[model samples]
Target: MKRTRRRKFPPCGRVGKWASKHSRSGKHMKTKTGKKYWLFHALSILLILMLVALMCLNRGNPDFQNYSNFYWDKDDFLKRQHEMGFFWLTRLGRLLNLTYEQFYTAITGLGLFSLIAWFYRYSKYPALALAFYMVFPFLLDIVQLRNFLVMGIALWAFSLLMEAKEEPTYRYLSLSLLLLAGTIHNTAFIYIPFWLVLQWPSIWVILSSGLAFTVSLLIPRFLTEASLAQSSSHVLQRYAYLFRGQVSLPGRIFFISLSLALCLAVYFIQYSLDQDRLLEAGVKPKAFQSLSQLAKKLSYLSFGLMPLFFQSVDFFRIFRNFLPLYWLLFSIYFLVPLKAQHKRLEKLVLSLFLLGILCVTCYVLLIFSNTDNVIRTVFKENILLRLIELRGQ
Candidate 1:
């Protein structure tokens, strides 16, 4: 009779433990990757498809109609709500004679690609990064063109900042790009605060946000009394808009509740993981502290949106500034096991995050399926069929 051998399986209690600890172990990485890695990627791919589906389904929107006003008359690219960069983009599309919808679709594709390029640098979990970008921000991107562009490039700048400590070139470049990012969308202004706090100490970010919030309240009074509100830039107008109670109550509640869940889930993961960073290779205490500080600041910035949600339902749009970091931390959280507190806090946070992630994914899927265009996009129309028809025309 041939000798039989037995293989050890990870225990039920320590499944999260073994996965976190041993996935890095040379002995276990290959054997364990199939179980943990595949599931994560599968979920990621599903979310990515939904992201694309949303953009594809929304071939034309109010923004496109706005763009059409400029394109039809072929007017001079004047300084409007859209900054120079955006007008130039529209100009190029109009010059090409591509329909506004086609041009928008193409550029949106490029934007998604640019996002992938920026996020690919700091993350190992590509699926999660793509999902994060393509999901929560999906609604805003559908209607807001400049914001989509600004968020993508600002994140590109943030990716540069993440490496600034080790690379002086990246440090200077990150700051310059951040300033440039501001011109594309006023929302990019948040990058300066994040960069400053990260370079100095992480604690100041909360103080900065508190100060800005106070300052924003003061501005609305000035803008209201003065004739400047009408002449102000779109972004400034947005600030003026956010300071007053302009948002719907039901809409604000839903927006704030969703944002709260995401922020809480991310914060818990970071808190749980901070305890174990010392164990990872090349992860210094000071470096991890810097990251922890960034996480805290981002979380606080995210929470600030809650009060703003009352004033502007679009307040959640600002979360785009901190989005890359959230996804980055999440990617790291999954990669790094909860070691210090070991199993208890680890599983608790991990389970919470998993629950939150799944809920968000399912929610997006359900919402997308309910759209009228989805049926048209899936069966009656598709990229390939559209391409053939365009050629025939």
Candidate 2:
């Protein structure tokens, strides 16, 4: 008798089965995404811990001695021709009755945590970006503690700037963070004009960066330390040293070639993105587009200033500031897109490219360790072993 009611129930049964399957698939995806997120977090934390251990345990580091001296002499520290953020940090450390070791370690840990956290949160391939950072700039940044701290702050501000397009209030917040970073290290001010023109066309960005580089070149020709030393402005006087030194011929060639190669790679990636409409289909189209444009502009600026690198190694600091953007660009456009293709050839190519990067990075680290007495401290001993020896001593 119930057979009459059971008739024509096929649509409802099919719909129920489809919904169940869809829900299971969604749940699996969510679980997979969550695991990946935690994995990245764990990796980031481990990296931060390793870096902090290396920097903090290396008491023989020349910069550590210099920073300690600065900490001991509060009045002299405040009076020095340095940014106030460092002075404030020293003051706070003293107020807390922290020893020089504790103070240094705390600041170093905090700065590194911030920097790695930013990379993990925003970067498409955070691990790759972190690896790139370690290869090129990690040692240098740790040596220059103040600059490292400023970089951490500047990157945080940059994250805010990235979100500013969606939420206007983020723009002001980004500006405030940048100002704070400037107080820590005046180079942060260089990012202000960049932030101002983030929405500009790629061509305009290229032109402006070229013009800026040209002006920078002219400034060295016109204004020497002698001229700047006589100026009333402390900022100008502080930068006078940049106009003094001459980089070696080998150094010039190496840096210029590296910059040129990187610039060409970025241009190639940009071309590919455009031709394939990858940006349109990318995870975050607008954000990635801005990243691509900014990366190109910064690459051009970095390359254009390579000649200046010959004038002074200090000019390379500008290149360092732009380095992270390059990592992000390459990771996003080059690697992420390739990953989506799931082709064995693409995967093999990616593996080889990464291997090449790692080899180059190792070569650089070895060179730095051998050439720079100060940097040699970093590689002299295993950090854990060093700490244990210190404890025993």
Candidate 3:
């Protein structure tokens, strides 16, 4: 028998490329993955730029005046923050000379970038993460600049804590970020609790969230009727504001029927997938466990608080924080394929899946378009055109 010459394979890295190019390999799959990642980053940068542009173009808002006055008419920055209680952002403004229109605009820009980065870091589907970031919170940031900025910092801090694993120094650094967020925005305290209990499973998350919902309903009445510490009443007053506003009956019905129940279902489906993957890997996935728990809690809480949204549409400002959890589940729902016994049934399911995405994309577009009540918005002509002109100048 003639001995054939044996070819020595190159390194493992090269082997993948060779196999991909020559055989039934993942050349197409890898390319698709790379494109998806590229799209994610591109969209993220675009949205951040849009946010900066909005801040720059819409400088006539009253808050912009306050920011500028803090710089020009300021006797002492510390005195102002003491009176206002936004110490962290005050320090940021003073340190960076961020009271300037351009400077604070830049700060908002950086905050948006960091916020998206935090979400994208752990997100299984970066596109979905970016989409949710754009749709709900991005607009709110334009108006509630300081509030969103503080929350954005906390969100970045949460990401740090999630990524830290058990490293003591990293955990401390994460806590420092959380502290910074709390100092700037008091609502940051709401999020700090989740970090302590990040390891809770879905069942516990559901139960705790339900308990929280019941507590939320009762606390407002208790705070109103009972005498309490000045600090306690002041804190509880935040929840007291929840029952003051009422959404239209039809709108409430629509949200409950079409949006809330579907969102909760998506979350449960994602949790099931998480369980299955954990079993398959058969190894500890400490990774993203904390985040998954957070998502589950937030989603369950959002469902629990659906009645509150009926009370006040503005509740969305608070509820929007939970929408990130919805987006995580939303992405997982689309990306993960369910096991099917029949291959043809899977194909039919694929068509239905694409149709569902189309329907959702249309609904979101329509919802944003029906901005009759919105005074300022993303669709205005000035964002890109003026952004380009300003950059050119």
Clashes of each: 0, 0, 1
- Estimate, for each residue in 22-112, the C-alpha lDDT of model 2 and write its tens digit: 9999999779866765775577567666677776655555576778888888445433555777778888999999988889778887887
List the global CA lDDT of all models.
0.60, 0.68, 0.56
Worst 10 residues of 1 by lDDT: 373-382
All candidates: TM-score? 0.68, 0.77, 0.65
Q: Taking the tens digit of each residue's C-alpha lDDT, what string does model 3 give over 154-217?
A: 5566555666657657677767776776665555665666555443666776676677668656
Q: Which pairs in model 2 have colliding backbones?
A: none
* Global local distance difference test of model 3: 0.56
Q: Residue 193 lDDT in model 3?
A: 61
Can you tell me which runs of candidate 1 are displaced by over 4 Å?
1-29, 34-58, 71-82, 95-97, 132-134, 225-245, 248-267, 274-292, 302-309, 335-346, 357-393
Q: Is candidate 1 or candidate 3 better by TM-score?
A: 1
Which stretches in model 2 have alpha-carbon errors above 4 Å?
1-45, 74-82, 123-125, 230-234, 267-287, 329-372, 379-383, 388-393
Candidate number achieving the greatest TM-score relative to the actual structure: 2
